[model samples]
Target: MAQQALPVRTARLGRALGPEPTSVSGVVLLLPGGEESSVRRPSPMMATASVRALGRRLARTGRADGLVAHVVHYRYRGWNGGEAHLAQDASWAADEAVRRYGDVTVCLLGYDMGARAALRSAGHEAVNSVVALAPWLPEQDVATPAEPVRQLAGRRVLIVHGTNDERNDPELSFRLAARAKKANRDVCRFEVHSDGHALYQHRHEVHALTEDFVLGALCGRGFSRPVEDALQAPPPLGLRMPLATGFGRSLRR
Candidate 1:
C-alpha cells in the first residue's frame, strides 16, 4: 500500500458511497475550516489545522498506534462557519472515511465552526463520537454562524471552548451545553483558560490536556494501560468543570 502524502481521508458530499475497508479499533477524521492554512499548507491549519496537527500528532502519539486517524480537508465557506457549508464537508468526509475504514467506531473532530460541521456530519453518519472543541452554537434569531445546532441526541459529543474567547462568548457555549444535556446525549464540555480562538494560543498543558480527551474519547471504552494513565494524569483530569462551565473556561472533560 502506498503511504498517504498528507492526512487525507475519504469524503463525499452528504452521504458516502465507496469501499475497500481497512480495519481498526477506531477511526477519526479531522476537518479544518476553509482558511488560508487549508488553501496554502500542503496540509490545512487554524482550528481545522490544529485538529489536523492533533490528528497527525495523535497518530504519532500513542493514540494512533492502535487507531486510525485522518485529517479531512473541506472547502467550507463564510467567516462564521455555517451549517450548509459544514454539512457538505462533514458528509463528504464521513462517507469516505466509513467506506475506507469500515465500521470501526468513527469520530469526526473539529473546532469552532468546524466543530459545528462535525456534529452535522455525525448526525448524518450516526457517528459514534464527536469531539467539538470551541464549538460555536448561538441562540435562535442570533443569526448564528451555523443554522440550528445539529441535533446530538444518541451521540457522544465533547464540547470545548475558551472562556474569554472574544469571537464566541461563554453564553454561546452554554447554550450549546444546555442543548446537549437536554438531548440526553453522552456529552461533556470543557473550557480552556488563558485561551483564545486558536488552540495554539493555549499552553502546552492545554494541548496535552486536549490530547488526552481526544485520545480517551476516540480510543473507545476498552483502553490500554498507558493510554488510560496518559489520559487521566494530565490537564484534562486536573481541570475543574464547574469553574469553566460557570464562565465556559476550563478544558476539563
Candidate 2:
C-alpha cells in the first residue's frame, strides 16, 4: 500500500497595525522579500524594515478611513520554486482578512520576492488592488512558465521598480506590467531612477505612490495627476512613467 501523505500546517503569524479588524473598512497586507529557495521557517527579522515602515505609513494615512495594515509573515524564507510557498501564505492572509473583517476590501503590498507573491495571489476574492515594489519576476524560458495576469481582471495593479536594481530585473517587471495592463487598463508601472533594489533613494516617493493608489482603490480617494495620467495613458507611456521626487511632500501641500 502507498504511504499516506501528511497534511501541511501553516501558522498564522501577523499582527494588524491600525484599527481593529471589526472597525476597519479595508486592509493592506504587507509581504517582505525572501530568497529564491528555502524551506527554513522565517524569522522575525526576515520581515524587511522597509516593508514594515511602509505598512505603518499606509496605516496612518488610511486611519481615518478605517484602513488597517497587516504584515504577512511567511512560513518559509523563500519562494520555493513551483511550490510558491510565499504566495500561498499571502493568499491565506487575504482570506483571513475577509474572515475577520466581513467583506472589507484588501490591497496586497509586497517587495522583491514578496511582490512576486502579491501578484500571484491578487486573484483572491478579497483583494481589490496590488502594489508590487521591485518584484522578482522569473526569466521567461521554456523551463519556467510566465506569471499569470488573468487573475487580475478586475483589480487595480501598480508596479514600482528601480532602474538601477542589481537584484531583480526591472525590464522583467515592466514586461509583466505591460501584459497586465493589456488585460486590465487599471494597471500602471513607475520607474524609480538611480535607485537600487531597496528603493532607498526614492523611498518617500514610492511610499506616497503606494498610499495614493491603495487609498484610491479602497477608499474612493482621487489619484494624483501623474498617477491619473499613467492610468489613462496608452501603452509604453503608462507602462514607463517616472516617479517624481518630493511626491510625499507635495501631497501634504
Candidate 3:
C-alpha cells in the first residue's frame, strides 16, 4: 500500500512597504505573536494588528533611507515547544530577504512570541539587528532550558519590556539581555514603567526607541542618548534602564 504524503507548511511574506526590494539598502521583517501551543492557522488578532501598525510606521519613516518593511505570516499559530515553528518562519523570512535583495542588512522587529522568534532567528547571516517588544520568554525551570544568547554575538539587540507586565516576565527578558550583552555589547533592555504586556501605556516611546535602534543599526544613524547609554552602561543598570516619557518627541527635536 502507498503511504499518504503529509502536507507541507510554508511561511509567507505579507505585502511590503517602502522602496522595492532591489533598490532597498535594508529590510525590516515584522514578526507577530501567537499562542504557546496551537497548530491552528492564525486569524487576525491583537498581536498581529500591533506589528502591522509598526510595520507601516517603519516603512514610512525608513522610506528615504531606502529601507523596506514586510510583515511575516507564519505557518502556524504557536511556538509549539521545541519545534519553534515561528522562529523557523522568521529565519526563512530573513533568507527570503537575502535571496530577493542580495546582501542588504535585515532587522527583525517582533512582539510577544514573535519577539522570541526574532531573538532566536537573529543568528541568520542576513540579520544585523533585532528589536523585541514585550517578549514572551521561557520560564526558568529544569523542564525548559534557558534560551540561548550565544547566537546574538556580533548583532545589535534591543529588548523593551513593561515593568508591570502580567503576561510575560520582565525579569526573564532582563536576564536574557544581560547574557546577550556579554556576547555582544550592543545588546540593551529598557523598562516601560507601570505598563503591561501590551505596553500600551508607552506605545509612542517604545516605537520611538525601536525606530532609533533599527535605523541606527541598518542606516548608520546615531542612536538616541538613552539607548546609547543603555548599550554602554554596566549590567543591571543597562539591563533595567527606564524608558522616559516624550522620548519620541525629544528625538524629533
Instruction: Give the lDDT of residue 59 in candidate 1.
Output: 60
Worst 10 residues of 1 by lDDT: 12-21
lDDT of 3: 0.88
Candidate 3 residue lDDT tens string, 1-253: 9986425778988889554544788999999998899887777555479788778888888777878999898888999998899999999999999887788899999999999999999999888899999999988798988899888999999999999999999999998998788778988899999999989988988888888888889888888889889999989898899999888885741
Q: Is candidate 1 or candidate 2 better by lDDT?
A: 2
lDDT of 1: 0.55
Tell me the spans in candidate 2 whose CA falls farther than 4 Å from its real position: 1-9, 19-22
Clashes of each: 11, 0, 0
Model 2 lDDT, residue 202, Cα: 88
Model 3 CA lDDT for position 222: 80
lDDT, each prediction: 0.55, 0.87, 0.88
**Residue 206 of candidate 1: its Cα lDDT?**
47
On lDDT, who's better, 1 or 3? 3
Off by over 4 Å in 1: 1-23, 35-48, 62-65, 79-83, 142-150, 221-253
TM-score of structure candidate 3: 0.94
